[model samples]
Target: MGIQINGKGLLIVLSGPSGAGKGTVCSALRQQAPELVYSVSATTRPPREGEVEGISYFFKTRKEFRRMIDQGELLEWARYVDNYYGTPRRFVEERLNEGKDVLLEIEVQGAKQVKECFPEAVFIFLLPPSMDELHARIKGRGTESEQVMTDRMQAAREELNQIHSYDYVVVNDEVARACHHIRSILVAEHHRRDRIFKEQPDWLEGI
Candidate 1:
C-alpha cells in the first residue's frame, strides 16, 4: 500500500518563455510523478488537433469564460490575441483538498497573477540554456510568421527578467535532467518541517 499523507496538497506553478520547453518538461515530470495532478485550464480558443475537451482544456465560449471571470471562478486569467485562457479555481481546489499535488503549467503573466492568490504555491520558472538557443527553438517550430516570431522573441527577452520572482529555476538543457531537478524540489518541499509536522500522525505525539 502507498503511504497516506494527511496534509493538504501542494499547488505548484510553472512558467516560462515561449520556447523554454515548459510543455516538454511538464510532460516528463508527469510521467515520472504519476500521482501529481495536472491542472486543466479553461480557454475560449477552439481545441487544436488531438486536444481533448476536459483533458487538454475545458473549452468555453467567450461569453461563458467572461461569466466565470465575473463569478470569481478562476484562479488567474489572461487574454491573448482576443482569446481567453485561465485556470479554473474549483478543480484545483478539490484536488488539493484531497491531498494530491496539483501542477499548473502557465505563462508568466498568469503565473504572476496566481502568485497573488496563492502565495504558498511552489513557483518554478523554466529556462533555456541561452537566448540564442531559445530563438532557435522558437524558429524551429516553423508555424509562426516572421512578424509573430519576432514578437515572440521580444516577449521572451522580457519574460527572462521575471526569473527573479520565481522560487526555483529549471534549465531545460536536457529533459531528464530538468525533470530530476523538479522531482528534487518536490521532495524537498514535502520534507519541510511545517509540512512534515502537519502530516504527522496523532499517535506519534509525545514520542
Candidate 2:
C-alpha cells in the first residue's frame, strides 16, 4: 500500500486585474473542489441587490472597519473606490486548522499585504490572454463609464508590475482550464517533500 499522508491545508491567495475573470474561475474552482473553503471578506461598502451579510461579505460600517484595523483583526486590507475591504484573520485560521484548504480572492494590493502576513500562502496571479483581451473584457461589462473604465485600465497596468511576486501565474483563458490548473497546483503542493516531511509519519521515525 502507498504511504498514508496527513497534510495541512493550503492557504491560497488568488488575485488578478479587474475583468480578468477571477470570479468566474473561482466559482468553477468551488464547483470542482467543494471541500475548499472560500474566505469571505469584510467590507465597508453598502450591500448591492441580493447580497446577504456574512454570506456575500461581512458588511461593516467604516468605524467598525477602522476598529478592526486598529485591533489587527484583518489578515489584509485595502481601500478601493472609497470603500474598505479586508479578510478577517480568525475564520481562515479556524478552517486551516481543520485541514481545509482556504481560498482568498482579493485584489493585488491586498494580496501583497497578505504576503507580508502569511508568506507561506500559495499566491496565484490570474492573467488575461493579452492586454487587448483585458481591455475588451473590461469594456464588455457595460456597467462603467468611460472615465471609470480608463481608470480601471490604468490600475490593471500597475497591477501587472507585481506579477513577479506571486508563486504561480495562470492565464484565465477558460474557467474550467484555469480551475484545473489550480487543482493541480494544490495537489502538487501537498506532495512537496518539505510538507510531507513536516507531517512526520511514525513510519519515518527510525528510517
Candidate 3:
C-alpha cells in the first residue's frame, strides 16, 4: 500500500465588496462541504433581525470587545460602522489543530489583518460581473436606504481596486458556478507539495 498523506486543514479567507454575493457563495460552499466551519466574528453592532447572538456572531459590548483585545484574544480586528468586529484567535486555532478547514467571510480590511496573522491562509477575492450589475443587485436586495446603497457602492469600488492583492479571484456571475470554483480551489490547495509533504513525511524520505 502507498503511504498516506494526512491532510492538514486549510485556513481560507474569502473577501469581497458588498454586492459581490460573497455571502451567497459562502453559504453554498458550506452546504456542499459540510465540514467547513464558518468563523463567526464577534461584533459590537446590535444583532440584526433574525440574527442569533452566538450563531450569527458573538455580540459583544464595545467595552467587552476592548477587554478581549487587551487580553490578546483576537486574531484580527477592525472597526466598522461605529462598531468593532474581530475573529477570536482561540476559536480558529483550536479548529485548525483539529484538522477542520475554517472559512472567514469578511471585508477587504479584515482580510488584510488575517493575512498578517496567518500568512499561510489562502485568500480568495470575490468580484461582481460589473459595477452596474453590482448596483442593481444591491438595490434589488431592498434592505438598505438609497444613501446606504450609495455608500456601499462606493466602498465596493474601493474594494475592487485591491483585487490584485488576493491569491485567487472568483468573479461571482453565477452562484453555483462560483461556489464550485471556490470548492475546487480549496481542494487543490490541500494537495500542495508543502502540505502533502508535511502530512506524509515518510513518503518523501523513502523516495
Candidate 4:
C-alpha cells in the first residue's frame, strides 16, 4: 500500500507587471484549486464602485491603518499616493496554522518581504507576451487617465527588472494556459522529494 503523506501548507506569492493579466490568472487559479486561499489586503483608499469592503479589500481609514501598524498587526505596510496598504499578519498566520495554502497576489516589493519572512514560500512572476500587448491590455481597461497609465507602464518596467528574483516566471499569453502552468507547479511542489521524505519517513527503511 502507498504510504500516506502529511503535507504542510505553502505561502504562494503571485506578482507581475500591470496589464499582464495577473488578476485574471489568479482568479482562474483559485477556481482550479479550491485549497488555495487568497489573501485580502487592507487599504486606505476609498472603496471603488461595487467593491466589497472585506472581500476585494479591507477598506480602512488612514487613522485605522496607522493604528494597525502601531500595534504591529500587519506583516508589511506601505504608503503610496497618500494612501496606505498592508497585509494582515494575524489572518495569514492563523490560516497557515490551520494547514491552509495561502496565496498572496501582491506587488514585487510585498512579495520580497514575504520571501524574506518565509524563505520556503513559492514566488511566481507573471509577464505579458510583449510590451505592445501589455499596453493594449491596460488601455482596454478604460479606467485610467493618460498620466496614470504612463505611471503604471513605468512601474511595470521596473517590476520586470526584478523577475530574476522570483522562483518561476510565467508569461500570461493565455489565461487558461497560464492557470494550468501555475496549477502544475503547485501540484509538483506538493510532491517534492524533501516534502515527501518528511511526510513518509518509513519510505526510507530500504535505504
lDDT of each: 0.90, 0.90, 0.88, 0.86
Q: Which segments of model 2 are wrong by more than 4 Å? A: 1-4, 46-49, 201-203
Q: Please provide, for model 2 over 74-185, each residue's C-alpha lDDT reduced to its tens digit, 9 standing for 90 to 100.
A: 9999988999989999879888878889999998888988899899899999999999999999899888899999999999999999999999999998888889899999
Better of 1 and 2 by TM-score: 2
For model 3, how does the per-residue alpha-carbon lDDT over 1-207 read when each residue is reduced to its tens digit? Answer: 575443567889999998899888988988988999999899999989999976899999999999999998887899878999899988898888888899999888888878888889999999899899999999998898999998998898898888887999999999999998998998888878888777676775644
Candidates 2 and 4 compared: the better one by lDDT is 2
TM-score between model 1 and native: 0.87
Quote the positional error of residue 103 for candidate 4 in Å: 0.9
Flag regions of model 1 displaced more than 4 Å.
Answer: 1-6, 46-51, 144-146, 198-207
Candidate with top TM-score is 2
Local accuracy of candidate 1 as per-residue lDDT tens digits, 39-136: 99999999999999989899999999999999989999999899999999999999998988999999888988898888889999999999899989
48-100: candidate 4 lDDT, tens digit per residue: 99999768899998889999989988877788898999998877888876778
Structure candidate 4, residue pairs in collision: none
Worst 10 residues of 1 by lDDT: 198-207
RMSD to the true structure for each prediction, in A, is: 2.9, 2.3, 2.4, 3.0
- lDDT order, best first, reads 2, 1, 3, 4
lDDT at position 131, candidate 3: 90
